[model samples]
Target: MQQHLLRSTEENLTLKTLCRKFSNGALIIHENPVRQVGGKKNAPHLKTTAYHFDVLDVDWINTESSFEADFVLVTTLNPSVSAIYHQRATLTLSNGSTYTPDFLVIKNGRPTIVEVKPHKFTVKEPWSKLFEEALSICETVNVRFEVQTELQFRVGNLHKRAEYIAFCARLEFTSEDILLAIEEVSKYTDGMTFDFFMRITGLPKILILKLVASRHLYLNDALEYEDCSMIYSSPAY
Candidate 1:
């Protein structure tokens, strides 16, 4: 009986390993972008801006518009967002029109196709119809579809803060600096103001912004960065 049980356990382990491999393969396949973003030389009409995201495997991701750029920045700061891709998928509508989404975001381990459009344009003709078709396609595939506007991305100077943080995050900083900042902030149970934290750490303002951008520290409810802004330690620590 003991010998039989050991053989069964070995077979189960092999099966589990194969299942894990299969799941990983499926995830990779799903994450692959259906269309590639073109550069200025290839597509003169489209304005491309390269954005950096540490969470994404690629060195840089390109955004076509300011709205898209803001979206990328804010999404990068979100702890729940694990991965992001630009122009990730192209879906065919029932009327034979193809629609390419602005972003493919992996948030909380689920895939969501997001379209960023101006508020005025969302209510207009062809765009409205196109969005409807895109929603249908996403629903069929069991993927989430969302339409984001400036209201969502530019909330109370959040985009401005995100952009500033992104720029500052590029500056040189060491792991020791980050650890020290976190340690100082963790000492305050209720958190502390940005100015107070800065005073205690003696780290440069840029490095503090870098910590916020990297999500090692968080901002106030509005996500604005200022002297009096409330700074909180990351719960992960």
Candidate 2:
């Protein structure tokens, strides 16, 4: 993949520039935040965190709040998401104000401008109008716009499962183990329960959960992680 570096000196790069670079199949890199995250004057109420997803190929991705952190974690686990950039661009709104979206996500080769916020704030002034302008601008550039909130992240133990899988992914594992697990699951055709898979593979649960985290094994997003939870082999295998 081609790589295009956006240095801190180029923080004022336009959205159209980002779109064009992405259209040319270049990996976009912005190593700085467009706005302050959790400074005392900026967002004292929210906690800040940094995360790294190997698939994104970035050293660290920083987020201002736990909500944004969860968004990063959940999005990183998605099989379709190809890349994620935090505070990637600064856009000029129609009202002469500027806006910086929380994330720019590349999924299935399409660029999506994502804004993470609490559910209550989405309906409030300034934010509502700002999102409207952002959506309008995105439409002109042929990019999709999305608003993600706690409601979406907190659905049906999805966040809990994502957290568990991420933790397990950090534990020791190997390509051979992943391959062996996938080979075993591929035989089931209709998928199998988690407990049954563990019994058959003789691989520990951590390895199995690691597979789920890395998306080598698929699980129902709406279901809680349990012995009975169904697991399927990724089509890639």
Number of the top-ranking candidate, with TM-score as the measure = 2
* The best candidate in terms of lDDT: 2
Query: What TM-score would you give candidate 2 relative to the actual structure?
Result: 0.82
> In candidate 1, which residue ranges exceed 4 Å CA deviation?
1-32, 39-43
User: Which digits, one per residue and each the tens of the lDDT, describe model 2 over residues 1-237?
Assistant: 112333333322443455556442112323455555554375577767777666554446777787888888888877787667778766776656667788877777667889999999999997898888888877776778899998998777567778888898889867888788889988988998889987888888777778777777777766355888888888876
Name the TM-score of candidate 1. Answer: 0.77
Q: Candidate 1 overall Cα lDDT vs. reference?
A: 0.70
Clashing pairs in 2: none
Clashing pairs in 1: none
Model 2 spans > 4 angstroms off: 1-32, 36-40, 174-176
42-90: candidate 1 lDDT, tens digit per residue: 5557656776566444445668778888888887888777666666566
